[model samples]
Target: MKKEELIPQYLQDELREINDIRPPYSFEEITKLKDLLDHTLKQEKQLEEAEAYGAIPKEEADITNLVLTVKHFVLQESIKDAIKQLENDIEEKKRELEELKRGN
Candidate 1:
């Protein structure tokens, strides 16, 4: 299939897999997969309901990577937000410094 056709198909298959909340290999590894299992179930519940309303399924690859991506975002959302805030602060500081230099 063409790359354009393949990408959306891949994303859809991976998204559907979230509905299958398999147990992690180790309970101690809960930091990653465990949290995601809970979140995924919630997200999947919504997705399933949406599908019932009229959502169409798509395509996939290893699928594990897709799960991993979901887990990463769920785990790191706070960190990502903090990073964004810090970046904005840094940009503002730079602008202030430039204004100071211009006035000097």
Candidate 2:
């Protein structure tokens, strides 16, 4: 097996792990992961532009890094959004409870 084939497999495995764990983590953790993802995305774009203009060595390494970074981003966003949604739902429930308590 070549390095290229190995990278995709590793990337997929990493993403799967992230997906599996994201549901239980806190919002702050997820936010931090999102920041990391944003940084990786910037680096990935830089690498792509560099490749477009010239022949670059070690391109595979950059691509693998990008894939992992993207996986992180996907998990981070998923968890963060889920937390936000749950928070909103809780807030709505609280309001309803308060209104019922007041009988208004």
Candidate 3:
């Protein structure tokens, strides 16, 4: 489950930023941003399952093997890219936020 499901997720230090932002969000824009965050969670769960099961190729799956390229790709590289996309969304939404304020 996303930690966001357990507790609200946002700028921890500026939570009022959350309350102040009202939404009549553009479905296209919000989905585009949310998809990035969702991808990371999906990848993480898949990585965990691969590790838990024997699905992982032995070389990348275990320390005694040659390298962990596949594991690193699934568990690290992809997740990092998703995270970066979400970070970018923070900046991308500034204009939308300004628009929201105008509605008030």
Candidate 4:
């Protein structure tokens, strides 16, 4: 199935925007986001089951809030990952500069 098919229609536009950002998401990052969405859906199912079983109050089983929270988390994590990769690249460049200076 297409990666787009894995994402819900409501989230497609947002995820596309994220994927289009500078530095963009790597293929691995996109896969991770898909996995996160899958996990969130599973969790939502569990919540519904719990509510049906009277293990949790119906009012507390808020799937919309859960989905939104997960979406926010995914965005934050993707940004953090991008920042970390950029930092690593900067550090590597600094090390290469030091080596060049020593050679000169």
Highest TM-score model number? 2
Better of 1 and 2 by lDDT: 2
The best candidate in terms of lDDT: 2
After TM-score superposition, the amount by which residue 42's alpha carbon in candidate 2 deviates from its true location, in angstroms, is 1.5
Question: Where is model 3 more than 4 Å wrong at Cα?
Answer: 1-64, 102-104
- lDDT (tens digit, per residue) of candidate 1 on 1-37: 5654644554455445433433322333334344645
Backbone clash numbers for all candidates listed: 1, 0, 0, 0
Off by over 4 Å in 2: 2-5, 8-21, 55-73, 76-80, 96-104
Ranking by TM-score: 2, 4, 3, 1
Model 3 TM-score, all chains together:
0.32
Question: Cα lDDT of all candidates, in order?
Answer: 0.52, 0.67, 0.47, 0.64
In candidate 2, the residue pairs with backbone N, CA or C atoms under 3 Å apart (3 or more residues apart, or in different chains) clash, namely none
lDDT of 4 at 65: 46
Per residue, candidate 4 scores C-alpha lDDT tens digits across 26-46 of: 657656665656665665677
Using lDDT as the yardstick, the better of models 2 and 3 is 2
Candidate 3 achieves a global lDDT of: 0.47
Error of 2 at 1 (Å): 1.1
For residue 92, give model 1's deviation from the true position in Å.
Answer: 0.3
Give the Å error, residue 88, model 1.
0.5
